[model samples]
Target: MDTRFLGIPELVEVPSVAVVVDVMRAFTVAAWAFAQGAEKIVLAESLDEALALKARHTRWMALKDGPPAPGFDAVNSPGLLRSVDLGGRTVVQKTTAGTVGALAVKDASLVLCAGFVVAEATARLLRRRAGDQVTFVVTGEDGRADEDLACAQYIARRTTESGTDAAAYLRRARESRAAAELAQGVRQGAHPDDVALCLEVDRFPFAMVATLEDPLMVLRPYAVDSLAD
Candidate 1:
């Protein structure tokens, strides 16, 4: 199996198995949403698109930024989403990195939105499908992405090898500039728990994959051992 990592905005050649990662917040929130029993997540290009889709669908919810401001149902913070009961609801999520990176690879044969919360599980599924070349799309664009690159490396090691130091990878990510900004966001009225919540490794035990169905890039979760070999 061959694997390479690239930043989202810099992506040129997309392979069959594309692992799009947004470890700081977006994909982390996606994992949490699935953990909360969200039925499916629709990746939208912008806030307008996300809200429009939500407005059109009676059972759909938009998880965009602004912390539940004007048009959005929920913010992009997992700390706030953890308290909301999303059972049987379809979520429309639009984020600067993760979801955008996901929809960018809409034509890829396989797209997996990943984070540390489901690192091992995502790698396991990738390992099972290692017959093809893989690309890790780090969505923290323009090199402001220590956490995402770290998560990608950890997943690559786990997918090809036997052991991984989840704690070490998390620690590497904690020292990044993004981590500091998120910590500061917590102080400035942002969700207080996310600084620690986003850092937690393997918090969820499933992998989130994006598929084109009914023409929407729908993200759904699969247990680590659920997919047939």
Candidate 2:
């Protein structure tokens, strides 16, 4: 299978396995929610829709940013989620990147959410599914993030053995050691906290897959934790 990278702009053209990567926050938060046993995740492009879903669902699970207003959910921070009890419930999230990327690629045959925290598991899942064509839709800070590209390179290596070295790319990306570096590499600029929250790896092993039945993505939690960055 030929592997191609799809930046946010090229989302409409790709129609393979969509690996939506929002390492900075959105995707990372989704992975965490699933680890906590979230029943479903509605990926909304606007804050009002996410908030409305939450309100209707009795406090829906959500990420920040979208129509209605920006910063409505406090800008997609994991620290904020620490205090909430999401057991047996679900979330409808909006974000500046990941969620929007997922919505952008909704036409894909299978849309799988991925991030630094769940990178390894995502690779394993992709390999198992072995979708004929694989496209990585990594969202940048705004529309560009070299770090996201670098991470996409890393993920691409895991999914294929085409003599492409993902380890070196990952190492280069990690060497910067600053959240800003990843954002800048991908051309996405954000607050320092956004970078900080996105770097933590393997916090959860679950990958979210959104389906039409609930409109919200479904998460499958794996029992593994702890992976080398």
Q: Count the clashes in each prediction.
A: 0, 17
Instruction: Write one digit per residue (lDDT tens) for candidate 1, span 1-229.
Output: 7988887767776679999988878888888998888999999988888889988998898887544567778888888889888999999999877888898888899899998888878888988887888998888855358899888888998888847677788887888777787777743324877767878878888899899996789999988767653
Query: What is the alpha-carbon lDDT of model 1 when measured against the actual structure?
Result: 0.83
Q: Candidate 1: how many backbone clashes?
A: 0
Listed in order, each prediction's TM-score against the native is 0.93, 0.75
RMSD of 1: 1.9
Q: Which whole-number lDDT from 0 to 100 does residue 19 have in model 2?
A: 81
- Ten contiguous residues minimizing lDDT sum, candidate 1: 186-195
Choose the strongest candidate by lDDT.
Answer: 1
Q: What is the lDDT of residue 80 in candidate 2?
A: 49
Instruction: Give me the displacement of residue 51 in model 2, in angstroms.
Output: 2.1
lDDT of 2 by residue, 1-229 (tens): 5577777887658476878877656776676676556666777767677777766765555566422344244345554454456787767777777777887877777887877777666666677666478887858744456556676667667666534555565554455433544446443323434555565654565556755455554444444334322
In model 2, where do residues sit more than 4 Å from their true spots? 66-75, 141-143, 161-178, 181-197, 214-229
